[model samples]
Target: ICNTVYRRIPLRGVCTKCGGNLTLTVHERSIKKYLEISKMLTEKYDLPGYARQRIKLVEKSIESLFTNDKVKVTKLSDFL
Candidate 1:
């Protein structure tokens, strides 16, 4: 049984008759975007020749909330 209520999806559901490719949809695009931006920001904002691994660890938190399209994030606060 799948519960979309809590956005709970089983990774792979077994088929009754014959087991087949049961793919689980994950939010991979978000992951990619976060990884890309963190790299860009850490380089630009932080000190030169700094610890990249540490930067990545710090970036994980910021990535969680940065979901909107980049332009859209800037536009909403402009409403007056």
Candidate 2:
């Protein structure tokens, strides 16, 4: 009996009914694109060449998820 709000479900529309910190948009293209960008950025910063940059990259990616203005989507595919 997981409440949709607590379950990390994609946002059903533009407004967040819960008014929580993270607002997810229910759109596949947006979510997929975010994942792809996160992955590519992760790989770039996680490489041996950028050993010191791993932390930076990871932080950036996480922040991007919340701060990205291009699209709003929280990755809930793991649950799907």
Candidate 3:
């Protein structure tokens, strides 16, 4: 997916809006693929403390990467 996106990118190195969205979706899916299974296995197998900690770190990193950083505000009257 990334390779395809890279090829489609312009020489200036900026991806088109579509390409950027595709790349983000691909990355998000791939990152989340094994997360649940990894945590389940870690618990089932009684993995070492470090291994568990590493998985937690990865989860945090993934969350940060995929989460929207922007904050949106609405007028208080809108809720009335």
Candidate 4:
């Protein structure tokens, strides 16, 4: 699963999972949105246990998508 996700990332460019082109800013926003949703789902709300578990997977995927860089220009895939 990690291999598939890693391969899906462009080496030095931006593209959606479907190979659709995306601006760097757009991709960053998309990832941030997912991260927020996952965080909310994990909170002690009215959500089911299973739902929170699934959202954790989404969070993990987002983690793999990028590195710990403050500036988002250097993609993690570039080091792959």
List candidate 2 stretches off by more than 4 Å.
1-25, 47-80
> Model 3, 3-75: lDDT tens per residue?
4445354654445544443432357877687998899999999999999999999999999887877965679
Winner by lDDT between candidate 3 and candidate 1: 3
Total clashes in model 3, counting residue pairs 3 or more apart in sequence or in different chains: 0
Ranked by lDDT, the better of candidates 2 and 4 is 4
Put the candidates in lDDT order, highest first: 3, 4, 1, 2
Query: TM per model?
Result: 0.35, 0.28, 0.56, 0.41
lDDT of 1 at 37: 80
> What are the per-model C-alpha RMSD values against the true structure?
9.4, 14.2, 6.9, 12.9
Query: lDDT of candidate 1 vs native?
Result: 0.58
Taking all chains together, the TM-score of candidate 1 against the true structure is 0.35
**Alpha carbon lDDT of residue 17, candidate 1?**
33
Poorest 10 consecutive residues by lDDT, candidate 4 = 1-10
Candidate number achieving the greatest TM-score relative to the actual structure: 3
Comparing candidate 1 with candidate 2, which one achieves the higher TM-score?
Answer: 1
Worst 10 residues of 3 by lDDT: 17-26
Tens digit of lDDT per residue, candidate 1, span 3-44? 233245344555333454344555657667767786887778
In model 4, the runs with Cα more than 4 Å from the true position are: 1-26, 41-44, 68-80
The candidate that achieves the highest lDDT relative to the unseen native structure: 3
- Over 1-80, each residue of candidate 4 has an lDDT whose tens digit, in order, gives 12224434577454434555544333667677867976775684768888877788877767777666565676889999
